[model samples]
Target: MFLIRTLHKWFGLVLGVQFLLWALSGAVMALLDHHKVSGEHALLPVAGLQAPAELLPLARVAQAIGQPIQKLQLKPLHDTYVYEATTPQGVKILDAVTGAPMAIDAAKARELAVGRWSGSEPPASVSYISRHTLETRDLPLPIWRVEFADKERHALLVSATTGEVMAAKNDTWRLWDIAWMLHIMDYDDRQSFNHPLIITLGTGAAWLALSGLILLFRSFRRSDVAWVLDGAEALRRRGR
Candidate 1:
């Protein structure tokens, strides 16, 4: 029993940071109710179509953009189109039809952010600014949906038509996003365990858990066999 407990404690101390990170990430994944980033109200009235407009031929647009299209989505209600395609660095977008830049208004996106911590508001940790549009003319489709990681580590969705802002959910889903990030110790894409302080704290948590598990296992030995068996049966029943 003593040996098991010691082993568990030492193991925890060694991998504490990783365990904490896992816990935090798991919690964030669980409590995230609305994973939307909010921003200034989208450019209003995206001119919903009664009938879809004859969109520019996606193939020609793709050639113009210099990349192959992966997917396309149109929102006539907002007179917008979104495309997803590949990029050298990762994925980026293009404005093939309307010639509008795929940029979003940061001030507007910020306005949509919530500041509470009830797992229902936008993230409250850091203020967000608009990201520049990553435009390319090398795609096989007229429109592209660009994938972006915001300064806040939120995934951004952009429109490729009319340069109009479509729906900004993450900037709006403010508080909830923060909780998840905090839970996982991922400040942003670059700041999770990548940060020294966060790494240390995460390690501490992992060690704590490992020690606890070891203690529990150690207690299951010798005269405690009946207790351990009962506990195992309980766990089995729960699993069933």
Candidate 2:
């Protein structure tokens, strides 16, 4: 019994901090509005606009890029109508009216991000990101990160190819992310919870629960059962 109790005490000490963090993180996530955390409120939706009266032909686009086109789309990149061409090399954008090739550079990325921003302030900073990160996880690489000069530090991610606002994030989301990291027990990537540390800790927690349940039963003494035993004897006497 003493051995079991000692083990239980040590386990509680080890897991207590993690349990408290779980509770706190859960509370924060619950209190936060889903819309704000997702940055949906910071970015505007793409509204449909009227297209140009005349568009350049597909032959002109082929001649300009000199690549075999797998697929093509005529769509609005903000106000400018452009043809998105999927070539063997990669995606190529060309002005639909003039058939001139268009590149999605840092300047163009800023335009796309700012155009989608719903806030009053223009972007505080804009940078081209070609690698994956905690902010850009699961999203396609080679994107543009646009940050706004606001209290929330509202940021927007724009696609390098299509000039679309792929994702939005803010200070609220960053705070919630810390809570999530603690809750999931994934301190590094904060993306996946199915790692070895969590699995080991989960196993320990399960053992603590099972051992605590056993201790519950073993904690009771013979005196605690005396009343029930006496009552049964009284019933037997009455029967006799």
Worst 10 residues of 1 by lDDT: 110-119
Off by over 4 Å in 2: 225-240
| Predicted candidate 2 versus true structure: per-residue lDDT over 1-240, tens digit per residue | 898899999999999888898899999999999999999988788868799898897788788778888999999898789999898888988999999888888899898888888999988999888988778886887899999999999989988877878999898999999889998989878988889988988898998999999999998887999999999999999999
Best by TM-score: 2
lDDT of 2 at 67: 87
Query: Where is model 1 more than 4 Å wrong at Cα?
Result: 1-4, 10-32, 35-46, 50-162, 170-172, 183-185, 190-222, 225-240
- TM for every model, in the order presented, reads 0.33, 0.91
What is the TM-score (0 to 1) of candidate 1? 0.33
CA displacement after TM-score superposition, residue 138 of candidate 2 (Å): 2.3
Count of steric clashes across candidates, in order: 49, 0
Q: Worst 10-residue stretch by lDDT in candidate 2? A: 57-66
Highest lDDT model number: 2
